[model samples]
Target chain A: MFNQMQLDILKEIGNIGAGNASTALSQLLNKKIEMNVPMVRILSFDEMMELYGSADKKVASIFLQFSGDLTGNMFFVLSVEKASTFIQQLPGLDQCSFVLPPYSEMAISAFQELGNIVASSYLTALSEFLRLSIIPSVPAVSIDMFGAIITYGLIEISKVSDHAIVIDAEIKDPFSKDKNGFIKGHFLLLPDPDSFQKIFSSLGVNQ
Target chain B: MIENGKTIKVGIADMKIAKAPDKLRTAGLGSCVGIILYDLHKKTAGMAHIMLPDSTLARGKTIHMAKYADTAVETLIRKLEEVGVRKVTLRAKIAGGAQMFQTASKSEIMRIGPRNVEAVKKQLEKYRIPIIAEDTGGSNGRTIEFNPENGVLTIRTVNLGIKEI
Candidate 1:
């Protein structure tokens, strides 16, 4: 349970991280990208799954593990369609045949780099803001059921606590005005239970 | 594949019991075990989606009993008994305890899937419930559907296709 002020502080952290990541993404795609307000929620395992609506939905995700003073997990997730679209538009990938479902080697590496850029941008922002050394592990790419991938991420924190602190930022493609047509992606961070204390203290909070 | 029957969904850290002509389903299980208890005599089934190996690892008082292997096994046994299924007539089948990401396998937490399988097996043995079949311990997520009518558990995965246990 976080106080209003604490929640605001976390939101501010998300804003800074998401802003930096969005800028990097715009450069990557050479297209203007937009981001919505970052939201921080304390959710149970069930609620965490609910955030994605349906667990069976296919998704392409890049996973990263955080090490150092503040341990956590982070990922950048996009729908399979959006991931394909983003990859096909890459400088030299237009001629590559678009495969279905499971991604090809070329696609995997491409997504991994995208994930690295986005996740590192956020981690770098956190490191600067909190003044703590936070190193993220190499990115691992997976294209599978959304629920399965997310469940994999939650296992670490679920061992220590029933609820997880999720900082979620929704990234949108500004060029597409159609709600459904726009490529929607999620940048998520889940700090371990012990790390929360360190994070709050680093932020000058006494929770 | 959608089965033609009343299907009850068991979400993450949840459990459910279904009678014959109905099915119990749980989706997106990764590093989490889906334990199914079947009663041959009464044609009843109970499923629990367990997340952790032990209840002691829980941070707070036992709030979600179904989320742990130890408590969930005991809870499912009780649920089956209440539905007129005798302990002697019960058999178990489990699936899903997958290491979804390979790079994270070096971390102990990433291997929780296999640990969960071991814990569930231990609990089943304690209750004298023999495991009939299982499809677990891979690096992939699974969606399972348990039908009490024929006492079949169908396990579906992204890369491995579908198999019935």
Candidate 2:
């Protein structure tokens, strides 16, 4: 449970990190990118699943494990279509074979590179702002059902608490919108239940 | 009304039971197991979407009974018994426990899908419930629907399409 001021501060922190990530992505693709203000929600696990819509939707997700001063899981989720668009942007990567099962080596590497850049950019900004040392592991790319991938990220939290603190940032491609009316993806940060107090206390919010 | 054959949905860390002309379902089982119990004679069914292996792992003040394999199996059986379904007639079916990311295998949490499956099976053994069928342990997500009338469990996955066990 966070006070109004603490919630506001968290939102602001998320926004700052998202801004840096968007900048990195825009430069990589040479396109205009729009970043939404980060939305922070403390939701029950079931509610979070409902908010995500059906768990069966296919997605391309990059997972990164965080350690150091603050420990948690981070994920960057993109629709398969959005991922294909990124692959199309990169020259001459369309013709590679046998990387991960069902995914070409080129696609997997592209996603991993993209994930690393975006996640590291976000972390760098947050670590500087919060003055905490945060180190992110190498990104792992996967294409799977949205629910399964997210469940993997949330298991550590679900063991101890029914509710999860979800910090979400939406990054959109201003020039190219998909049939879904949005060519956007999500950057999610899920802190373990025990880590929430450490984060807030380190930021000097004791209440 | 049981006339419409309505479907009862069990969310993650939740449980439910229903009778004939009705079904129990759960979606997006990554590292979680969907355990179903059905009695052919009564046409009654129960389901729990379990997220963790044990209740002892809980650190919160409130214990979510349906979230752990150890408690979920017990809670579901009691609910079915309350509805006049005999525990001796109950049989089990399970699905969904996937390691979604391959590179994450090095960490303990990444193996939770397999662990959940093992825990669920162990709990069923403790209750003397015979497991009729199971579709578990892979790197994929699954949505499962259980029909008590025919005692059929349908598992849907993005990669493997659909299969009935």
Candidate 3:
């Protein structure tokens, strides 16, 4: 139950956070990265799955849970191909294969670190902007079905409502000329239902 | 007569029924559980993709019956009965309930997979239904399909490929 103004505020928050994350990523890989304006939508569980292509689509996801003034879950999701591409960019991991399990420890760690850097930058920007103390848990990496990984973030929200407020930011690598771009990923922010009040109050906006 | 070779899909917090020559399927079960209540004699089955353990946790105005283990089981059984299937002849097969991400935090929400499995078992016991088979409590996501005609449940995982229970 959010008005247009409230939704705009959340979108702006996503925009700033994603901007910082893309900058961090570009620095790490020495590649030009582009991010679109974040989209804020309240959607049902089924609709949320569809947004990511489908429930069974395989993905590489980095998950983190944040606590403080505004508690919520954050996800950095990439397609299997995109994940491998990013992983290969890391030093000495050019031969890493992320297509199947029994994945090498070095590859996994490299991917995790990549996620860690980008997510930390994103959260840092948000924390500064909102003037809220936010602490993020250690990043956890998983390669699985998109629906399965993403639904983990929905557990807390599902208790309160069937619908969730998803702030989705899409980031892409500009160098690749593929039909869908070279490296594309999504940073999804799902704040717990109770945390909405704290966020609104911090912004001096009535919910 | 049944619709041959058609699969009825059950979405998260949703439910559906299928008859002989037809199947019921649900995809991407992370910490969620999929429960199937079927009657062999009637060649019919009902499936629910449950997201939470109980309806009491619902803070919203309207409760989605298929979203909770307690309510989903009851509602599925009732729906199966409406299709001329006897409650006493009903058997259950369940799957999904995975801890997709490993975290040091021991919050109850983090262990929801096991909790969901337990809640579903409790509901089935309350209804006097015997569990025929189950594939649960792994740290991997599962896509499950149930064939009412042959009473076979098929489970697929990203790492383990596919298996039938």
The best candidate by DockQ is 3
DockQ of 2: 0.63
The window of 10 residues in a row where model 2 chain B has the poorest summed lDDT is B97-106
Candidate ranking under DockQ, highest first, comes to 3, 2, 1
Please give, for residues B1-165, the per-residue lDDT of candidate 1 as tens digits.
456779999988889999978999998888889999998667799999999899888776545789899999999999888888888889999998887777744877778889999999999999999999998887777889999988899988776678999
**Candidates by TM-score, descending order:** 3, 2, 1
RMSD of 2: 2.6
**Model 3 chain A: which ten-residue window has the lowest total lDDT?**
A174-183
For every prediction, compared with the true complex, DockQ reads 0.63, 0.63, 0.78
**Candidate topping lDDT:** 3
On the 0 to 100 scale, the lDDT of residue B57 in model 3 is 89
Candidate 3 residues A1-207, lDDT tens each? 788889899999899999999999999999988999999989999988767676977888999989988889999998877888888888999888777887888998899999999999999999998899889889999888889888878888987888889889999886553355432798999999988877788899989
Q: For residues A25-75, what per-residue lDDT tens digits would candidate 2 score against the true structure?
A: 989889888988899988888777655567777778899888888888899
Candidate 2: misplaced stretches above 4 Å? Answer: A94-101, B1-4
TM-score per prediction, in order, is 0.92, 0.94, 0.95
Residue B51 miss distance in model 2 (angstroms): 0.3
Interface Cα RMSD of candidate 1? 1.8
Docking class of 3: medium
How displaced is residue A150 in candidate 1, in Å? Answer: 1.0
